[model samples]
Target chain A: MAGYGTARQDHLRRLRRIEGQTRGLQRMVDDDKYCIDILTQVSAVTSALQSFALSLLEEHLAHCVAEATRNGGPEAQEKIKEASDAIGRLVRS
Target chain B: MAGYGTARQDHLRRLRRIEGQTRGLQRMVDDDKYCIDILTQVSAVTSALQSFALSLLEEHLAHCVAEATRNGGPEAQEKIKEASDAIGRLVRS
Candidate 1:
């Protein structure tokens, strides 16, 4: 969870930029920009989102997962499993 | 180029949904959603953008590149090289 004031601000800002990039893709399509050019932009946005997700995962592992691991219970296993699944999804996606 | 009426419309619609997905991510972060849930949504958005890129690339191949190939000139090689570079970027990203 990224609810802290500064963390939340950082996420919103990144998402806003990603949203802007998507809008730019729309404009590129509307204007009939070169195919390769549009594809380049799409890759840019995808990479941006990918990096964002990676950082979020790192934070999750550091905070929530780390806390659970410290507690040493069935919940710790559950948290580890959940985080593993999330990482799998990210890689496969 | 996706400047045609229906084709452009389709592209724009897809981008709009991707943008919506991104905004939803912001909301999830703001709401302090579970880390795995946010990560899942991020993967979804990434996959959506990826598929969109693939389709657009298909169209480019079917149209622009196809046309260049039919003409049989250096331009065909250029188009192919450009497309390959774009695909590389997508895969690397």
Candidate 2:
């Protein structure tokens, strides 16, 4: 959890900005902005989001799952399951 | 970048565990582990990864992109572009 906190804070900040970018994208749409321009922003937001996600995924694997395995048990197995599901959602999303 | 440091460490830790799970999965495959069991582990890793990604995206939106927008300029737009592209990759990957 301690590991998650700092990371969580960082993620929160990034998300907020992405939120604004999304709004801007909406405005661009509303104002009849150029297709390329809108697409460009869309691409940017997407990349930003991916980078953020990557960071988190990395941590979950390193800390959470690793700790579980080290501790050893059914819970560790459960943790592994949980992590895999998360990746699936990310890919699909 | 300062914000990224603590977050990065957390991510690294999680990644290590996911890596181990992946190895286990590979072994399971080699050992002819049950299909359901293998898939289940895969799903778990995926979910964990996604959770991590989500957190990072959130931070990017809140801090980096927000700062860019608040500062106001082409850089912000560029940053927006960067972020969007990232999300696109995440979705596709």
Candidate 3:
């Protein structure tokens, strides 16, 4: 679907950018940047990354998961289990 | 790397389960399940999905981003930028 494609593209772009920020944070450490400054950036990066994940999760639930559940069956049950385990990991982290 | 592989495998398993949860939610809707109950499950599913994304992002930062930044250069900078944008999107969502 066009909508899915657009969303995916956007998601990919954002992910790539996050990947870059992560690298920047590492560089800060290596360059011996001020501890406070590094920590601040690190915090921002963490929050930013967390926010992105939240968005994707929201979308997945609203669309993919919702649609699949509507159809109902073995596949649907599998998806629910998959989601539960995934969530468990996230919360644990 | 073996570590990455193990982590990836774990992540994949979680994702698949979440996928199943979403489907279950859909079935509930079709079955005309109670609104409150459905909403409860939906909320749980949302939380679970978010957790999965967070873990992946954390890993990316700890392993991929950190390593790339240590090596330093255009590639590292690029990765940092990618991460930033991704975080921005996540927060926005």
Candidate 4:
């Protein structure tokens, strides 16, 4: 977690921007925008969320997973499993 | 795109809620929340987006892809390819 401390603000800012994008998408739909336009917005939102997820995953790997592996115990195994599960879900999504 | 017309409003509402969640996540980080707690929120956001993507993909497959397959032309081929590419990216993400 401490490892992520430095990048925390950056991630927060990115998420906030994404939040605005999501709201804009909602407004587009509410306004009865063109079909392709709406779909394009959906694609953009999906890509933004995917990028965020990838960054978070990278942080988790470099910090939590690395620490757990270094510790070398049940906690390490649990952490690895948790990360694997997350990756599995992401890929499936 | 017309196929999605019926469910458009539903999707918009869902996206709006996700936007709120994203803003909340930003607030959590800004307030210096606990690491694990923030991570849990991240996981929730990821899951929400994943579900949205899955639903959109399903709609594309059932309506867009099915229509394209029925048409049986170059446009059909293009649509099929587009859907396949989208699915590929979603899975990779």
Candidate 5:
């Protein structure tokens, strides 16, 4: 079970939308869309993905991290470190 | 014809890969993958899309923007403005 269990359905919905956006991007490229227009579409897709990630991260923190820290063990520290690393990756990516 | 004419095939290839990545993400979420693992994959997909956008933008700068600027007319300024706005959207996204 993942921290995002409660939000799994929502996550799936978001992913499906993103997948559609990716297909839209392919169509834009294939149809010889203007450079600026394609870039705008890409930006929209990227933003959608970012929002999905943020929502997932929030769920993870609220569930997994919260549970670990509540237990007050070595796993708590490990979870914090892991979450920080994930956040770093998201920011730098 | 757009600025990325020479790179259109490459862009299609990249978008196809991104589409695959997005589907993989859906699988990960569906499989009850660990939260951190899923987030890491999301970061990877986001990075891949960023690289795609940057490459397309570079091609636009070199092809369309360069051609417009070389013409040294009102449209030249217009193209520069349009490109700058696209860049701004990419950055904010």
Candidate 6:
């Protein structure tokens, strides 16, 4: 797999932040916070994570998929299928 | 605020699934799963949640923002600002 390098670091940071948010959510539930309030926080955390995914997907396209396309043949086809499957998953999610 | 109705239900279902995934993650940790394995599952759950978020964001943009934009004037500006802020947060996340 192609390394994301700097982008990987940024993503890890975001993931760690999201992990903290998830822990906070668990705490909120344990503390019996208002349902609506907890839901709102959940929404925020979801959005943040989604943004991170979008960034990663963008990077994959700009680098991995693009590189595969440039190379052509079976590898390109596989990359295209992978990207399509990913997008399909996102759409149905 | 306008309701998402069926779309809301879909989102809720997806969220519930994600909640289950999160619990599974916790269990994985409790069971002392290998670091790389846990990280792989974490990535999967993160991607699933991100897909859910992206769906919600797309709906918001297509529905709420579009409605506001059609209305024009101060409300339009507010909606536009809201969407921009949301995108900004997603980018920075």
Would you estimate the TM-scores of all the predictions?
A: 0.94, 0.48, 0.47, 0.69, 0.97, 0.53
Give the alpha carbon lDDT tens digit for every residue of A1-93 in model 3: 311333555545554554455456445444544333443454554454455455556665666667779999887787677667655544543
TM-score ranking from best candidate downward:
5, 1, 4, 6, 2, 3
Candidate 6 docking: what grade?
incorrect
State the DockQ of every prediction: 0.70, 0.10, 0.04, 0.34, 0.86, 0.06
Candidate 6 lDDT over B1-93, as tens digits, reads: 332434655655665666666666555445544333444555677666556545655766777778878988798887777767655654443
TM-score of chain A of each: 0.92, 0.84, 0.76, 0.91, 0.95, 0.91
lDDT of 2 at A41: 96
lDDT of 1 by residue, A4-75 (tens): 334777778989999999999989888888888899999899989988888788888888888989998999
lDDT of 5 by residue, A29-79 (tens): 888898889889888988898899898889889999999999998999999
The 10-residue segment with the lowest total lDDT in model 6 chain A: A30-39
- The sequence of per-residue lDDT tens digits that candidate 4 reaches over residues B58-81 is 776777777878988898888877
Kindly report which residue stretches of model 3 are placed more than 4 angstroms away from their true locations once superposed. Answer: A1-93, B1-4
RMSD of each: 1.7, 15.8, 13.9, 3.9, 0.9, 9.3
How much of the real interface does each model capture, measured as fnat? Answer: 0.86, 0.20, 0.00, 0.34, 0.86, 0.02
Query: Residue B24 in model 5: shift from native, Å?
Result: 0.5
- For DockQ, candidate 2 versus 6, the one ahead is 2
- State the lDDT at A39 in candidate 6: 42
User: Per-residue lDDT for B1-44 in model 5, tens only?
Assistant: 88787788999999999999999999999999998898898888
Best by lDDT: 5
Residue-level lDDT tens digits of model 3 in B1-93: 411334655655664565565556445545544333444554554455456555656666776678779999887887677767656644543
Better of 3 and 4 by lDDT: 4
Q: What lDDT does the true structure give each of the candidates? A: 0.87, 0.72, 0.54, 0.72, 0.90, 0.60
State which candidate, 4 or 5, has the greater lDDT: 5
Rank the candidate models, highest lDDT first.
5, 1, 2, 4, 6, 3
Error of 6 at A11 (Å): 0.7
Q: What is the lDDT of residue A26 in candidate 1?
A: 89
| CA lDDT, candidate 4, residue A91 | 62
- Please give, as one word, the docking class of candidate 2: incorrect
- Candidate 5: clashing pairs of residues: none
